[model samples]
Structure formats: structure tokens, C-alpha cells
Target: MTDFETLGAFYLGKRYDMPSRARRDDYVLYDAKDLTTHAVIIGMTGSGKTGLGVGLLEEALIDKVPVIAVDPKGDLGNLALRFPALGASDFRPWVDPQQATNAGMTADQFAAQQADLWKNGLAGWGQDGARIQRYHDAADITIYTPGSTAGRPLSLLKAFDAPPAAVRDDAEALQERVNATTTSLLALLGIDADPISSREHILVANLLHHAWREGRSLDLAGLIGGIQSPPFTTVGVMPLDTVFPPKDRMTLAMQLNNLLAAPGFQTWMQGEPLDTATLLYDPNGKPRGSVISIAHLNDAERMFFMTLLLSDILAWVRTQPGTGSLRAILYIDELFGYMPPVTNPPSKVLLLTLLKQARAFGLGVVLATQNPVDLDYRGLSNTGTWFIGRLQTERDKMRVMEGLEGVSGGQPFDKGAMEQTIAGLGKRVFLLHSVHEPAPITFETRWTLSYLAGPMTREQIRSVTALAPAPAPTAALASAPALSTAATGGGFASLDARAAVAPVLPPDVPQYFLPPTRDGALLYNPVVLGLADVSFANAKLGVTEQRRVILMSSVDDGPIALEWDAAERVELEPSALEQRPHDGAAFGALPPVATKARNY
Candidate 1:
């Protein structure tokens, strides 16, 4: 067994360790105590934050700690393959190791051998059942729309009605921290959990009171039924007009329709919340660990929806103390979405409470963002440890420098071997800092490529994420006679039933992988690049699910502005407006992924 019980140094060039590239003395190790602190990892695009993060997770999992990951890009799916690759009986025969390690291997041998790491023993999901199941279980769905008047849904706690499982001892305080979460959520939704003016409170309180009166042993479905109320009488009863500004609700309606079409989601959410081990449904058998993929999500609505689910999970984990004997870790790949004070911030105040207190409750928050500027400073101040990566801006650098000292109590720490902005910008090396480690060190991230290559191309996405074109609703099912949704005594399922959607890509639906065919073709797709989950508003899936619109280039344009309809499609583009004066000032370079098509 490994000597350290918690996080420590990575295998570091130990796999590729060589005096030829740099001296072994240059290596820095991560501190175990930092596991108790908050960590912030920053780096410019492509600076290897993924590699570093995979390394940390691999170590933690090996030590038997369960981790929950928010993999916006699905990059961390490979953490399950960290089984000491170069040992005497392993696959190191392919990896060339200078004259010393190369005696037994070749480059081709290495390439072919590494591919096997992608298997999960089943089929596509890597790492057999252990890693894949962990992710599948943690995956969930959430959907929120901009200017949406629907208000937040009933929280799991309110839906269930049972008082928190009593804390057994002071040592159990960390696990029992769920007691304080309702307040945190209240702060996030800007609703008064107090049952006063927030309007949703009475309903919420009623939902909770119902859970208590109904009985504590009931499952989630029973709880969903207990609080089920008529849509008009429920908070949903508020007139659509009073909730949204105008026709924006139409867009919200359309977006929900899209999610209703995806079969993976249909099969995923069909019955129980516990069957799938999902982030939202949890339908699968509950595994002790999970990883949610948010790569497909790219819009504000989806991003925020995902944030809500994560916050909800933090609350859910509180209810189950013995789900497993090991400590649980929540490693958010790109923490900005959850922690950022951006245009639409989730309950930052409530999230902060979790950040500061959850560690004690067995929830470790790992915030990794390339842009530190977006993180809500008030909440971030709660973090105790930080993984400082290669930052682009001097302001970011300074804020990090100062924040480190403050969090560490001016404890005379080193910013690692590559602390100063200098030559040691290796992909693996990062300026690591923590409250317990006397000095920060420049450490390399673990190389997890044998397992990380997951996202298929656009064609793959279209087929994988797409459904088999759901069959048309029969007269009865279409009327949802069971819901009698419009019926006077309609059930809550009927209320949600009326709003169900069927995905049908319109003629104008754009392709995400297309590029500008003609030069000077500018397509501005309002994309939300995150290291977190993006979800359908009122739908399922988080983490790797993204909300984004791929708008093509405008042939005719003055100075143009972009507007997103509620459905998250590009409702307004430069060409859609009359030409204004054109004075090319300056703009940032576009991400390489954008493709454009000419309009006739």
C-alpha cells in the first residue's frame, strides 16, 4: 500500500521522469494536509490543468476516499486507470524510458497498450464498473431559463419531509452539516426559507410538513407524490405573465421540448430517482462514488441549472452517513460556474457556507478554473488550500499571491519551484499551496491519457446524445389522459406532463462542429466555456452536459449584436439587424472549434 493516507506527490515524471528533460530535484510534492483546505487551480487554456487534476484525484481514490466530480469536459473520466502503470507486471513495456526503461519497450508498443485503458470491462465506459459506475451514479439533470418565472423547484429535503438523520457524535458533525443547508439554498434562490414573502415558502414548508406527517421511511417517489399539488394552487400557479417579461416563456417551452426528445434521458428518468445512479434520477443502484459530465452544455441557463443540482447533491450527501465508510470528495473540474459571480450566479452566499463548512462534513470542494477573476471572492475566501496554475493576467497573479498569504496566515510559504512567472512552465508543474504544508512546491500533474480520451467527434455526439426520433404521441398519450393534466384534479406529474417536450431539430438548427468556410467569415456563438456541468432547464443531466448555440457567420452586417432566445438559440445576429457604421476596433480571437456556413 502507498505510505500516505491522503493526497501527496504525483508519480511525477516518475513515468516520464528523466534527467534529460530536467533534473529530478526540480520535482515538488503535494501536501496531504492541504486536503483539509480549499484549493483553486488556474491556468491559461491548454496549460495542463486536466493532467494535474487527474493526478490529484487518482491519488485520493487509491487511498480509498470516494470522490464526486463535475467534469464539464468529461476529462477526468480516466481517474479510474491510475493503477501504477510501470510496475513489474504492468503495461510499461510499450513506453520508452531512455536507455534504462526503453530496453523493454517501443513507441508503437506503448500506443497500442495504452488504448486498453479505455475499457470499463463492459464496453465503452473505461475502468470496468468501478470508475464508470461512479460517474454514472453522480450524473444528474437540471434546467433553468433566463428570466424564467417558474421559480426554483422543491428541494429534495422539502420533498422528503423527514428531519435530518440525527448526528451521532461531535465527530459526525461534518456529515450532519446538512442541517444548515436549507438556509444556504434559501440564500441562493433569494427565497426566504422563512415562509414569509418569498411566495414559494408556504409551498416549501407544506412540502416538508407533508413529508414529516406522511412518514420518514418512504422513498423519493412517495415523497414526490406527497407534496404533489395542483399546478394552479402550487407556486407554478403564478400567471406566466407575472413571472416572465414577455414571450420568453415560449423559448423556455421550446427548450424543454428538446430535452423530452433525447431517449437516453427518457430511459434515464422513466421511473425511479434511484435506479440509474444518476445525478438527478439516481435511478441506477447508488454507487459510493460518481462523476458528472458537462461537456455538452454551453449556455447560461444550462450552466445555472447544473449548479442547482450540485448544490442539491451537497445537501443529499448529508442525509446518508453510512452510504459508505470512506470520506467523500466533490472535485469540480471547473469551479467557476459554481463559484463565479458571473451574470447569473447561483446562491453564492449559500454555496459559500458549504465551502467553508462542508470539509468538516466530509465534502471536499476542489475549485479548478482558468480564470480566477470570475470566482466570487467572498465565497472563495473560505477555501484553505489552493492549486495555483499558469495564470495569464498579472491582476489574477497578484490576487492569487495575496489570497494565498491570507488563507495561509502569512505562514511563510513558497509558491513552489516554478513560483515566479519564469521558464519552468511544464504542463505538469503547478504552484501548489496549502495551510498545512510549510512551503508551496512546483509539482507536475499525473499523466492520465491512457484513460482520458472520451469525447467522440460531432457525428458521434449527434448519434450518442440524440434519441431515435421518439414515436408520435398516440391520441390518448398525447392527451396524457392519465395526467388529465388540464383536468381539475390533475396530479403534479400531470402538471409537469403538460410541459413535456419532443426534440425536433428545425431546418435552421446549426451544427456545433462546422467552421467558417470562407475567410473573414465571423460566427459568434455565445458559448459558455466551463469546467462544470450545463443542464437543460427543468430537464436532466449535469456536469458534461452543456447548453450552447452554434450561430454561423453573417454575410451582411454593420456593427452587430447577438441575442439569445429563451430556447438558447441565436435569435438575433449581426445580419438580422440593419447595417451600422463599421469601425473595426479590436476583438479577441475565437476558439478554434467554431464553424460557419454562408447565408443566401
Candidate 2:
């Protein structure tokens, strides 16, 4: 019998109640206390990485841990729609997991178990009927008869407060001109308003925060006018109202932007809020559930939201009382465009730092990337847990293998077997390894939530909040805001600076850091840091008690007569004989780490 088994768990539309005969490919138990070190999930496209990431979070939230799922692809909004019906189903016949043997379980037994799980309403996981609202318009589409040729489009603009509709369809002119105009407008707007840039996000945030401060409502044009020039304007595309149709759609969007621009009406939210934890919790007396930044904005706007929140979240966390206790997790899916700009490596570095020590402060980060090459060697090495799934390329598999110390750093490395096994692993069965556990356990992720996550369409994203017209600037764009850290006022900017701080030493340095890595990879092997000297000749023949010097003792000890020789420097780990702290460690105990399981 396997030491770890769970046969009675329910699954999609079925249930199972095996009696402690759970197969090796079910799920691995992670002692929550051990999770403080943090984790990583790496796999190729369609390998169920996203599903697995959500599963862990589903469990964690039940465990009462706050979490942040960064959906650069804008899929996490489903969480808002993840209702109780998720995973709660009993409508189908029970069946055993794939290919159970008679001893494993007869078909009848499998059916019983399946029935049991489904009957318990522990069916699949997550909200089975979770919804992904493509666009606000899609959800609340109000049909408007072209009121007239001169002004129907213009009237629509008034509804959304879009710039007075300039394009006019002539009953006399060629139809081609009218069609071309509409096409140009849609193409320019990119059909949907997702993928916003870092700049645009801040603009929205800043506008809201600023308006919120003024205590008065200002519409889109009013806000845009405020940010018309230079730096702030350069961050993202300025023309948001074109899609909103100031005249055609509805005025509520325009009114809401101003209200959001105004501090009081805009949910009383201020600044960009992103971080592994706070995104999960409502801060400053706010609701802690979720913020569905409707994907109605353009790509630049969408990207802006991602970057601003990330930067802001880091800033917010710093405001928390202390280090070594951040308990938050970030779920990043389809993580590419949102990574640090291709020109900047620091962005990757910034994310890795967040992963390394999130545990101390009670933070956990999960990255689900389709492109395996994006996983960094240094970052992945620091993760406490790793879920690696199937891959298409030998090179990508090799990249993952490099994360294994035995294979990458010239220590009895086995590239072929590891690579072959990983490259061929079945779908949804991930190779799970973590700092707290040595053996690379394989399991099908516990299905805790319905898989409603899918790519977004351009039209679907535009329906949420439409862009508000920029307010014409009557005064210098608000003063450049100075961000103060938590020690002072608790704002998002301050938290970011602190989160971005890098460690000063390496993991094996024997220094006490929540996460051992400070900045770059440690250049030394740690095993030697605590070794005691055992040279027989160094025993001194017990002559030390008598204070007598032997001929051999002086061979190298005498400063006056011995000839000096130089030896080539071989890399050696620091040891107790030399590495002991002048002032000993406060705790005087080894750091928490998982023991290596000797066998697979």
C-alpha cells in the first residue's frame, strides 16, 4: 500500500471512495506550515498548468489564506463569477480513475466510489457555471435605432460621451466610404480594449486617485484634459472615449469614470493596488474579495492595469508591519506580455524576489506559463515547490532539468532520463517537487474548480467599463506625487519600493535571510560551511599539553625558517573551522528545508 493515498475524493460529475488505495497520481499533501517557503508551477501549453494553479488556490482560500491571481490574459475575472455551484454536482454515474486494476479496484467498486463523491456534491472544483463577461455591452446591450443619418452615431457618442461623432454616412455618397470609415475606427481602437500598457494603467489609477481627492465628480473629458501633456500622457494611449461613444452608448460610463476619477464615488479606492496578498484582501476597510477591472479598455489600458497593480501591490505589501510574515499568493497565467519589458531583466528579478520570501510574510506565488523557456534558473531554484508538465521541445525540457541541482551544476547530473520522463509526462499529471519535499511526486491536480478559463475575444473585452473622455486641463497636471513607505502613510507606491529590494548575499552564504538568496546566485557550495577539520597530522600528537614542539609541527608552523609555497585555489565551501559567525546565529538552529527522498 502506498504511504500516501486518498481514494474517496470526488471528481468531475462523479465520485470515488477508494479505501486508502489512492493511486500515486492523485495529489500530494503539502504541510501548510512548510509552504511558507513558496512555490512554482511550470508546464507547456494545454498541460493543465492553469487548472492546477487554480486548484491550489481554491484549497488555500478555504484554508483562509488570502490570494491574488494576476490574469494578464484577463481570465481571473471568472473568480467573481465562481458561484457555489462550482464543484457541486451529482448528476452522473460514478467511475474510477483511468485504468484501475481488479486489485486496484473492480469496475463496481470504482462506480461506487464515483457515486459517493458526486453524491457528496464534491463533484468537480470551482464554480461550474462561472461566467466570463466579454464586454459590458455584451452583458447589457441596449439597442438603438439609428435615430437619424446626421446624428445617430453622434447621438451614440453623447450616450458614451464620445467625441462629437465626426464621421457621417451620406445617403448619396458611395457605401464604400461609410464602410471604410467604420473599419478605420474599429481597427484604430483595435476592436477591443485590452492589453493596456503600463502607462495607461497609471493614468486611470492616478486620475481616480486624484479625482477622489478633490471631492467633486469630473467626467472623462475633464480627466483627459488634466493629463494632456508630456510624461503622464506618454504612458498610454489617450483616446479612450472613442470606444465609449460619449453620445451613442450611455452616459453612466462617462459619469462613472469621473466618479472613479472622484475619490468618494469610485469605490473609495485609491492608487494602483497589486500584490500577492492584498489583492485577495480588501485593504483600508474595503471588501477583500476581488476587483474585476472590466476588460473594456484597450490593450494599452489593460497592460497599464497589470503593471500598475504589480508595482502598486509591491508597494502595498511594504506597508504591512514586518518582514518574514507576508502571507499572500499571486497566480499568473499565460505570463508573457506582462513580464518585464523585453529590454529589462530587472522585472524578472523583481518577480523572483517576491517568490523567494513570500512565505515568511505568508505569501505564495504561482506562475503558469505556456512558454517553458521563460522560467528562470535562479528564480525556479528558490521555489519551494515545482509542478512541471509536458513540453514540446527537448530544449525546454532541458531548461527545466537545469533547475535540478544534480543535473545542472555538475553533480552527477542525469539529463537524458529526467528530460525524457518530463517531456513525455501525460497531460494533467505534473512532476511536483518542492523545498519541503525531496521526491518529485507526480499527480493529477485535485480538481477543485470548474475550468472556465479561456482566451478573451476582442469584442468581448470592450463591453466592460468604456474609456472616459479626458478632461481638458484647466491647471497643471496634478503635482508629481511622492510615494512614502509604510513607516509613514500607507500607500501603494511605498510598498513597491520595499518589495523591489534585493538580497545582499547568496543562498549558501550561511547568512540568515528569510529567503537565503540576496541578489545574484550564490557562488559557493553550502555543504562546506559547517564541516569540522579532521586531518590526522593536525592532531598535534598530543604534545600541546606539555608545550613541546615536534620537528613536523615546525615544518609549516615556523614563521622564521619555513619556506612558503602557493597552492592553486580550489573552490571550497566555508566551514565551522572558519565560517562560524563571530557572533553566533540568534536561533541557533538549521533553516527549515525538506529532506531529499532517496528514491523516486
Question: Which candidate comes out best when scored by lDDT?
Answer: 1
TM-score of 2: 0.43
Provide the lDDT at 224 for model 1: 24
Expressed as tens digits, the lDDT of each residue in 165-258 for candidate 2 is 1111222121222222222222223342222333333344344334433333233333333333211323335553443222322233233334
- Expressed as tens digits, the lDDT of each residue in 244-327 for candidate 1 is 322342343233334434453343233212211242222233233344555554544334335445445545545545321224
CA lDDT scores, all candidates in order: 0.41, 0.38
417 Cα displacement, candidate 2 (Å): 3.1
Number of the top-ranking candidate, with TM-score as the measure: 1
Worst 10 residues of 1 by lDDT: 578-587
